[model samples]
Target: MDMIADFDLTAHNTFGLKSTADRAVLIDDAAMLPELAKASAETGRPLKILGGGSNVVLAERLDAIVAIMRIAGRSVNQQTTDATIVTAGAGENWHDFVVWTVDQGIAGLENLAGIPGTVGAAPIQNIGAYGAQLSDFFQSLTAYDLKTGTIETFDAEACRFAYRQSAFKSEPGRYVILTVTLALPRTWKAKRDYAGLDRLPEDATARAVLDHVVALRASKLPDWRVLGNAGSFFHNPVVSAEAARAFEDAPQYPQVDGTVKLSAGWLIEQSGLKGFRLGPAGTYDRHALVLVNHGGATARDIAALATHIRDKVRIRYGVDLVQEPIVL
Candidate 1:
């Protein structure tokens, strides 16, 4: 792979902001990792692993050498009476992995379909959607210990998964996930417990769940290629039950479990920032939480808009909305 100096990362990220990377390397093969590591050692630059670039904001130029994981492989290892065991390469597209599983007649990951990113980054964030998460179907994985330069296997519990957080995310740059092993069912088991999808038919199978989720998302979210967005911009701010109760009398609050789950979109809209534009970066009119790059948006513009919205919400609702995407 050619090592380019001062590459523009705006095109690499989903936000489409113009930012530079001091150096970047795309690892299409795992065998080249040693060489890449050696080069980094000589250069004294830590490598930043990036995937589909769906969930990050380019805040500043990346000073370190960026290592884009491109390792690709997929295999089904076991076919039991009720389930099938499969493993996906780190560089495989996350949505493509879902499609592959569905094509193999496997169940359990359909609800998480259409999330933009890579298979390797999936476990890193324990990405969740429509009542399902990457952990639900995950069995284990082999991640390379960046320091030891050795691959090690980690099972489900070792991941320390919770909501939208994971061990990989907590300890960034420590491991490079090589392959993900998943346990899927041959039979249908839909996570239809979440709202909207709970109306599935009596015989609703995995395929049905997949179709329904895709249709639901098609209605709610805008296509990133056309409109330029990185899905949800902010995570649902989780608050205490007492905080939720205070809003119980309010018309805009919803309680989830014992915590108060407030929709960041609703808050953004309430703050009258929907369709609000700042130098070509605007909040999607249909979905307030989704920030769109309306052609020629700079990284500075998007960052300003995010900060503006965040400040507005805190001032108005007394709740601080945290940005979901990793801001570099």
Candidate 2:
């Protein structure tokens, strides 16, 4: 397998941090991964499977061999009376794929519009937004088992999906996602259970929901292409119902099982950290949930800022906020 040595990863990661991998190989096809895996073992170098890099925070130079997953394609595998199964390659841009499904008159992914990442990374993160999650429509996925170099399939149950998590995430480096197959509804239905989406008109269609979600995301989130960020920095902290009662004025969403999910952004803003800046790394002025790289911030700068934010929130509200991005 051909590889590039000392490859720069500034443009690859969404945060735009200046870091380099010891060596890198672009796997445009899943068939090439077995050889790549063998090469990694022979070279005695660890392998890091990098997707869109939207949910990663690169801390420093990596000594491992970076395997960039560039596998690409998408097609309608089959269609039933009520649902259509759409399969996409791991490299397909997630937002573009969502728009494609909507254009094909397939619903169920509209509320997850505007999310940045590759489709392969979706199941790993169980990516969610508004009211819809990828698991809600996930049918199955094909992945490569790095250890055995064998291809494997996982149903939704096998994926073990939870809120912003999956088996792939819990066991990193064990499997490399190759393709994702989702069963979308033929009969369109708008998901409006989440806050911004809940405010939409009752007659909202799938397209309308997509547009509203896109608009809402664009308004709230800083464009990572312009201003470096990894979307939401922290997961909305879930606490016990009794514990949530202490913060009566805080915005809280009660789950089906009676747990309460508190808004991390609200807690940060309430702590007076909104627009807080230390050089290029700071909490975003418009949305306190986001940590931004203004221009020339490094991973250390961002980490320090995140640590400060987490500490302040923990001391103030007794709620520990966990970061959403994978810190590499």
lDDT of each: 0.83, 0.90
Which segments of model 2 are wrong by more than 4 Å? none
| Model 1: residue 314 alpha-carbon error in angstroms | 0.8
The candidate scoring highest on TM-score is 2
Tens digits of per-residue lDDT for model 1 on 94-152? Answer: 88888888887777789988888899989887999987788878899998888899889
Alpha-carbon shift of residue 53 in model 1 (angstroms): 0.5
Task: Give the number of the best model, judged by lDDT.
Answer: 2
TM-score of each: 0.92, 0.96
The residue-by-residue lDDT of candidate 2 on 34-113, one tens digit each, is 88788789989888988888999885688888988889999988999979999999999999999998888777888888
